[model samples]
Target: MATVLPEGTANNTAERTFDSLNPATDEVVGTYPITTPAEVDAAVARAHDAARFWDELGFAGRAQRLRKWKSIITRRLPELCALVRAETGKPEGDAQLEIVLAIEHIEWAAKHAKKILGPQRRSPGLLLANNAASVEYHPLGVVGAIGPWNYPVYTPLGSITYALAAGNAVVFKPSEHTPGVGKWLVDTFAEAVPEQPVLQLITGFGETGAALAASDVDKIAFTGSAATGKKVMATAAQRLTPVVIEGGGKDAVLVDADADLDAAADATVWGACANAGQTCAGVERAYVHEKVYDDFVAKVVEKVGTVRGGSDMDAQYGPMTMRSQIDVIRRHVEDALERGGKAVYGGLDSIGERTVQPIVLVDVPEDAAAVREETFGPTVTIAKVRDMDEAVARANASTYGLGSAVFTRGKGVDIARRLRTGATSINAPLSFAGIASLPFGGHGDSGFGRIHGPEGLREFARPKAIARQRFSPPLSLTSFSRTKATEKLVARMMRVLHGRSR
Candidate 1:
């Protein structure tokens, strides 16, 4: 794989580098340059220069290029998925699913950027009735996106694609674990828009990421652990660079008594185990109504029992993308077990060399690490709640609230409203992530800012407000010419409009 290098470093034979390994077999998939701080600066400078051309392209010009990029990705779906599977160690289908969602987001961002970010008329209000006001979103120049390994394509592109569509150049530093996948995306983007390096890639370890954060980018978009997010924020603080951090999530699921048990079980199991539960928004803990706790637990356990993780094609999922996370899974399971939790399905033995089989823990205390922290493994804790009220309370009691799910026949929407998460799915798990029209991101420890939807398109751009005088105001309140009478009239108007007893 070709690693995009800095201008002066092309001939440096002694440049540092690192190898990306396939988590399953520990085989070296590819080697990437450990981009130096100077190289990162070079990339950011190039992005800044490119941003001028990109911004001048205007909405229609940018959308046309984005659509071409999207079409290239759609046609090469199989090839991209193969690279994703090789780097991330996820099942082929799972990789494809993420790419498909990414493609949809690219389409949405391209088609909607004009409508969402274009200039729009705003009501002038009574005081300025003669003035025409409008707001338009302009690109933030250059965006520095630091992606995560688990959902490399879908997550990073969430920022990269949208930033490009909004007419900004992007300097992306994907996860060290999935550099190949990141390189593939950048390469394909070059294929689509070769005139300018609107999107560039720099691969390395945490040092490289920090360099990009501290660089002179207009905005920093990071997806990783909250601890790391804090570090990114601190680094970017030096420049006062704006940032959107999509941090870790300890998402929950609420199963109401009236929920379809079979459907709920299916959603919960798939949500918890899909991609080996590496999903930031995956169901890490679930609260079931007492009336259906026993039945729901049985269903979840039975489904989890049959699921397996391996490198084979028939495996339900593949190994953990990052081998170090294996210990985190082990510790959480042990902690839950020591805290009186019982494994209804796979247990301690499920934790393997690089893969974790589905493990469902019941009776795990809400305060247990497994239930409170982001395990990022195929393990979920189920607890019984007396009522939906209790379930909602317990579910909302988390520092990280990225995404959530509520299963019910009658109260799905109502219950979803009470959730403190970024996005909540009714009768399903992770449904919000697939919808390009819905914004993604979370509150508190889950981080702030959104990534998908109309809100997402606006995230990378700055709003510019304009007010033009359509005609001179008859009252002439601002003029020194007879302003007292106009001021009195304005006060009376304010009273009539706002000072109402009703």
Candidate 2:
């Protein structure tokens, strides 16, 4: 694959370089610099300075620039999608879907940020009605975003676009395995606004990410495994720099007895296997009502059989993006079978050279890793539950509450609301991700903070409240000339307005 980075970023020494390999073919995709600490700091320093200019542009100017950037990505989507497929081993169609959603978010942020973060008048309450109060969200200066390999473009852009719309420069640290995709985005951003380095890329390993986490940036946004997120938070804590952590999740799908079994099964398979199941909100476990568990399992098995994984266009999915994750997938599947679970579909032998055939385990122990932890592979565990209540209970039992889905003819929304996840969809598969107007994030081990919609605009900004005196009050509460009689009058007024009835 061709390099996406600018000229100066290429490394000259082998030790200082890291190669991104096509997971399906195990071929070198491209090599990127193992950005040093100094390089990371320099990039942040540049973004820090650029933030002043970006912030000065105000919402209107920044939104226009962001829209330009969004247009460029939309126009060159084919090229971007191909690069995503090359680096992440995802199919071009899947890659396109991700970029398409990302572009939509950029558009939404550009169009709505000004309205969402602009100054708004507010009541000063009964005690201060004479004063005029208003509040506006100000940019938090430079923002450092560490991206994940899965859905790299779309996921990172969730924060990057909102930050830019809120008028903050961004220093992005793309996953080392997908640096080229990151570079493409930053380079295209530079094209939109040629005069400024508002968005910069620093491609490297964990050390580079660590430096950025502790840099002078006003805030950090990280998306990755829960363990790494903790380390990032710790590093940022040294300077009391705030962070938005989008951590890992072991999401589940709850199927109700009254639900449409065929639709539910189809959605479940897609949610479990799409993008090789590396999605943070991907469904790794399914809880089906006992009345329809057998039928649902049959549909899932039939649908799964139609899907295959490879580097070819005919394949439904691609290989695991991270080579090491192959073992994790194997371990989870094997452990499930060893712990008395029966494979309703693909089994241990389904694991191949670089691809893992869709594996569906039924009756897997509730405590099994296949059901408890994030497998991050094209595998899922199906269990029969007594009722919707049982399904909800089991789903909520997970410690990672990132995303969830419920399939029910009647109680879909009710069950979805009961789910302890950050985002839950009713009778649909990961629908929340496609909606740009909704905020996305997780709770507990899934991490905190939102990225999208009104909440997202404020996430990258600090609200500044202003209270201006409109007219002089009858009594000068702040003046020493205030008489005891006036103070007593004020006390009487307070008692009348807020005192409890006797």
Candidate 3:
């Protein structure tokens, strides 16, 4: 019943719109409006008005509404997951997993916002003993969230739910490739809090996203490529608006000599190929100790042997949501082979018009694109290292340090701590993202700012510090009426308190 146009296409007789297609079938799944710059600005204006009402609903009231929305999503999980599958071309199981994670985040943000953002007393210290101080987080007026197509539901909601829980209104701009999923989330949220447009949606291509970044929103939370993230930052700089950019990662997995060969292999295969390797933090590189390198590669190659990517129901994963990625995957794999890498499993022929078969290349040069770039596809490059030190060194050499996993018995946490990544899973791949209490983000080119946990709630709010004079100070330092004697006393006291460390 609904119709739309492609990106940048204009309609002579009606409002401009675009169609979202099923990546697997190449069939139109749904259509959404091609929201223009004017519409994005108007949406931001509405969010500012709604922000006051939403913020006034204190933590308790906001939590109640958020829980209702959570319940709605949980009860209709299957229906929403089905829509996600159709729109994103991920398998139904993968789609369900994404929704389940999103629901968990919503519940966590609702329950913890008060404890994390409410007013808290602070010690004034000896220098200001007469003053009582406290700090509370106040919501930013409005947040602009630009989401990615991969893991569309879970990823965007990370920003959306936390911002709402922090008492800020949100304007979400989902990737054009998955507009239907974005619309579904906003529509359902409205049903829960019909009183205000607390969460709104804007759909289109890059132009729409650029407009959002350049809008009057208080902050921008973006998840996409590093190059694109730079553009968003440049645009937001025009207004000097703050932003959180989760650029993609060339994440790595470190396999130690004492690690469980089988388990490490299994984690590597799944981490590298899951959701057709569309994940931003997916494992793109593996550095295994020379002692266990051969065994780990053997097990991983065996595990990948059973993996399949296609439109069939039995397939392990679905087609590439963005078709352009297929060529990128092909190029990376070919480049690795040309540079003397050996394909332990699939190779150049594994890349297809739609889906990519699991490809495992061993002995790939560290400087190869397959190892250095964020190849968002079902591929991984494995290299042998002399020891855990070398493995850690190679893993930390990447310019993008979003996520990493370290597999070892006694040194799991130690190795994890040594790696320079936003979050590291000690024994499991991407385990940090599943923990609702842990803040998830990255360093270096993978982008900055955080989502999830208390840090996430604080990301969308500003800390307002408060101080009150409860009594007269022992030293009247504020007054110049008796400064000569007071100054001498103050200098003596400062030396006594700060000149030496206890």
* Predicted model with the maximum lDDT: 3
> Residue 21 lDDT in model 2?
77
TM-scores of the candidates are: 0.96, 0.96, 0.97
**True-vs-predicted CA distance for residue 320, candidate 3, Å:** 0.4
Native-to-model Cα distance after best TM-score fit, residue 425 in candidate 3, in Å: 0.2
**Residue pairs with backbone overlap in model 3:** 5-17, 5-18
The candidate with the higher TM-score, 1 or 3, is 3
Q: What are the clashing pairs of model 1? A: none
The weakest ten consecutive residues by lDDT in model 1 span 1-10
Using TM-score as the measure, what is the rank order of every candidate, best first? 3, 1, 2
Q: Mind giving the per-residue lDDT tens digits that candidate 2 earns over 14-77?
A: 5798777787776788888787788888988888889989989888898889889889999999
Best-performing candidate as measured by TM-score: 3
How many steric overlaps are in each model, in order?
0, 0, 2
Ten-residue stretch with the least lDDT total in model 3: 1-10
